[model samples]
Target: MAKKPYSNEADYVIVGAGSAGCALAGRLAEAGKQVILIEAGGPDTSIMFKRPGMITMIHSEPKLKKKFDWGYYLSPQEHVNNRRLVATRGKVMGGSGSVNGMIYVRGNKENFDSWEAEGNKGWGYADVLKSYKRMEDWQGPDSELRGKGGPIKVLENPDICDAAKTFIEAGASALGVPVNPDYNGASQDGMHVIQENTSNAIRFSSSRGYLTEQELPTLEVQQRGTVSRVVIEGSRATGVEVIEEGGQRRIVKARTEVILAAGAFGSPQILMLSGIGPAEHLRGHGIDVVADLPVGDNLHDHLFMPMTFAMDNSPHHSSAFYFGKALLKDRFKPGSNFLAHSVFEAGAFLHTSLSQSTAPDMQLFAIPWSYPPFQDDPVRLSPDKRPSLSAFSTLIRPKSRGTVRLASADPLAAPIIDPKLLSEPDDLKVLLEGVEMIRAIMADSAIAKHVKEEYEPGPGYTGDKLRAEVIKRVSTVYHPVGSVRMGVDERAVVDPELKVRGIDGLRVADASIMPTIIGGNTNAPSMMIGDMAGAIVLGTGL
Candidate 1:
């Protein structure tokens, strides 16, 4: 544990340099305000993070993931055959956005409107549109809804394999789901190729896009800086106590406010550590309460159950040797490199027959490569064998809620993350229907031409058998939010303006503040919150 002199203050002190923190810090600094961004992880040095092909290797390869990943495993899930799933959260500068699959999803317009309807004013689709438009530099074919000339490069991968083409077409002809070229556009009902946070086959993360250009004298970013707790004076949050590399402690003050942008799990854990959670829970940890609130409650996330099918000859190949040769020469056109995009290039959304919800409750996406079965329930995956297309039946709007509680009083100890997945019966029902829909899509004549075999939940699987397979196979899609929820209710962590309910000069600006989890990828929404929250805190518009 070496030591270095740390800055004592800034106008705004933002903890966790994740999606929200980057957008907030960048916007505040750009507004001519002094800002300090702190992150627990080290620098973004891995070349794997720069290349899309190698990013998922972080999920598979242990050595590559060790540097930035928190590696937190959850408690055993009772609904999912009592299996404990590993939690994958990035501890890097850009937070999860640094290591996450860079699929850019703005979520549905109704998703934000639902937030406002839940007593959070000004978070409606129309109101929050400016923040997203302000942050995205859309490179794809755009209309008035899309934004241009923003910092984060939002580009659709121009290159698509013949297999992906068939997947999109089958969604329209077979499943009755329309072929929407852009899901982020007017309607989110149909299947379309996903846009990614990339430019010229290079990853565009919050750390790279937002913080990289903020070399201004006012903005200071500290890496390997773990925030122990928010220093509260009476009922107001004044600053944060940070532990730098090698056991050094520093108090970084915030003149305006202390913003907590540490994601869903981390934010609640920090709040509980700071003695700002449920009263009885705080006393049990032997810490004096600051502002007792439901900091770690209302935790929910998206879960996906993958079904793979052996396909006929596909027009795609995973040749790492040839890719390496091309990478060495640095030859790739912007948005034209297949290696830069995740294999989950195409996706579809639908409202299940069982559910009466207007918005699509189920999301479907395809991965070209055959991934190993989840926890070995006999999905018959061949990762290196013949070509297989895997489609994930995902539950975006989940009814099951969970919690993030402190395992101990120690700031360094990882918190107990129990998503309590599949705890609700409706969740299981929706997922079952989703699987049924995906099977129908595979059975369609247009898609059936490519299918060689049904891997899991095939002919014999019905009723109890299919239900058992779903519980065994369903796993998180890595989008966790709503731990530190925002609302006007008594249990709400923050208000509409994102102010901590029981504390002054404190706010939370991240995915944690979402009242309900959005119906799609959360990375884009998280950054949008950062941008909008920064403006609200500064009392200005972008």
Candidate 2:
């Protein structure tokens, strides 16, 4: 598994060493094909990346912007508070998974089936189930729904707080939603324990899980290299132009194909920078248009509104305290009681509106303690401070589509990300229902005894009051997808095989290609796309 130098040519050139990039690189290399992976960020070497609860520490670190984070900000949306939301992307090898909450959600099966219905061939639930199974290594009991041996480790913890347990019971009872043992099992519409990407109390990022030391020889990962644009010849990508350490620009040709696994933002940006996006927009930036396909026109993301509560009893479930103490303990005694640092204990997926034909459109992440926004600071909540619970409701399958357009002609300039959340009135209706649902779950008698007061929106706030509050606080979960959507349509950026609609030797293998966002987290699905892309590149899928 010796590291190999980047040669002048490779069978495949994969951009961005993020979740999908890592998976694609490993899989392509495993097929005995030479692959070169370029990443803008440096290597993932932070101690916080290995610790389960150290996500807070990583978010707070000043070096986050320089090391593992792209630190992009979204344009102000007029629909919400007109407040600009901060979008953090991974700059490191593992990408956002290294900085994320590490939740291993596969989303609802029906979500994929819907893609098939929308003319995206070979992307139905059945087709993706195999990919999911291929990537997972479940630590819990084996079942038809769970995978036993795979790259990513998915596990559940039994040390969750009593508040979390009671919330599940009471919340389900109040809403008549059944309790499900596994969200990935029989059904996705119920309260259940969350499955996390943790292995023995350590965060298992895709870089560590898929590209282990044993697989390095097959994969040549190049870090600290900023990709400028895709090298295209006669509307077909053949290589990439990158800026090396000393600001030296070099072109590396690909013998077979060029794959863009650079996540949602990076993927679409790269395509547009290479003159392969909407002709009108590219022309506005003074760039020559190659294909004029709609590369960044169909952006979508999960918008979340945080519903909070104020409690009256001291609890040991605070995420901040757990992570801080875990870090200190790791410095003193490594591998001693690692379970104490796990962040998410339990979660649920539900249909905010029962009448909708769609599956669960909202997901609830139940945290037993309170922390600052993004959990980016030390535990400031005193031990004597009352414990609280929060239900972060995200609109999973949003119909409102936006775009990522070039802010300038410069390839190094960041793209303008306009998610346009809640542009459709129905989306707002679903969000309002989500807020009401959270209230209903909290009001359940099984856990009502611990409730003290409503912290957000207040008790008197109802109807339009609550709706207004929702619009005021709603923000993105950073799960933007579909900018370079894949489908069998004339306007689609990529075809069913993930090849750019009107181009050859180029494909997008990231969240950007998803015709729509899944019912839950995008990290797992992104990696699965990467795996599928690797197979497609090797001519296995064809």
Per-prediction CA RMSD (Å): 2.8, 3.0
Candidate 2, residues 18-54, lDDT tens digits: the string is 8898888888888888888888887776677777766
Please list the residue runs of candidate 2 whose C-alpha ends up more than 4 Å from where it truly belongs after superposition: 1-5, 312-323, 335-342, 371-386
Off by over 4 Å in 1: 1-4, 315-337, 375-384, 456-459
TM-scores for all candidates? Answer: 0.94, 0.93
Clashes found in each candidate (C-alpha, N, C closer than 3 A):
1, 0
What is the C-alpha local distance difference test score of each model? 0.82, 0.79
Q: Considering every candidate listed, which one attains the maximal lDDT?
A: 1
lDDT at residue 542 of model 2 (Cα atoms): 22
Model 1 backbone overlap count: 1
Worst 10 residues of 1 by lDDT: 375-384
lDDT of 1 by residue, 428-520 (tens): 888888787777877776777888887754657789998988887888988999999999998699999999987998999999999998889
